[model samples]
Target: MLVDQNDQALRIGPIHRSVAAVTLSDLSELSEQRGDSFEVLTDRERALSCWTDPDDDMAAFAVSDGQAWAVLRTKRTHEVDATVLHESLLPAWHVADQQVGYHHSLDQALNATSRQPGLVVAVRPPTLAQVMDAAARGLRMPRKSTSFSPKPRMGVVMRDLRDA
Candidate 1:
């Protein structure tokens, strides 16, 4: 899979169906587990309950008691250019300096700039602080500034979106 110009191509073999596809229920459970894990670490947090019904390819639902949010969706995966994402992270830091309200994704801020293709996943608001901190400390980041948590298992997750 090709995420950007700097990202090296990731080669993956055909998926093995023996491992049942991830379901909505699975995601909901994972979310709950994650929430609970977080709660245990902080009393201010709580785990939300969630469930799901089969949709498209999978069945799922999620509920966050603390956030009062629910997400239900089919099981699907796709590849996005990770390269443009790398190059875009810095400019995003400069943009984050504006918004007063709490922001979620860096891509959201950049969205107001332009709609050119090749953008990757959104960058979290905290990334702005990180970018500034790095500069203040006289350091440079390589790419994909900060991945929150639970990044997919390296080889376990692969993309086949590259065009040869």
Candidate 2:
């Protein structure tokens, strides 16, 4: 499911899934080490463009410190990017698991940074096939890595057992 800037819900399948993160860590060094793998940007709007632009799906993830931004890309698919993010990049930054907050949408992430002050890392989510492949290989992704959307409505999906 996708929610527009208006907060209107749009029912859709897993065409493209991206998760955003809010943190206080500086990712420039990591981005620099990655070299051509990362495309540095100037601000959030540009980073948003990098994510939404269909002409370029190369970006695995994008990071911003509210001023400077960098988008990470790979010749491989998003699944690999997700793996590298969880397994390597994040850990190198010394970003504690608790210090990170995951947002299902870019807007939510940017909003979070606006409310507080921190860096925002927007990640491309893995496809269902990629997830299944990982599972078959006995690999595990980090928690909150994927969010199945159009979640069941609270009251509609549950019942009061007492009423039974």
TM-score of each: 0.21, 0.63
Tens-digit per-residue lDDT, 16-44, candidate 2: 22223434334555556655366677776
Per-residue lDDT for 16-129 in model 1, tens only? 000012222443465354342111212111211222122233323222222123343323221111222233322322323222111134334234223332111222122335
Clashing pairs in 2: none
Cα lDDT, all candidates: 0.29, 0.58
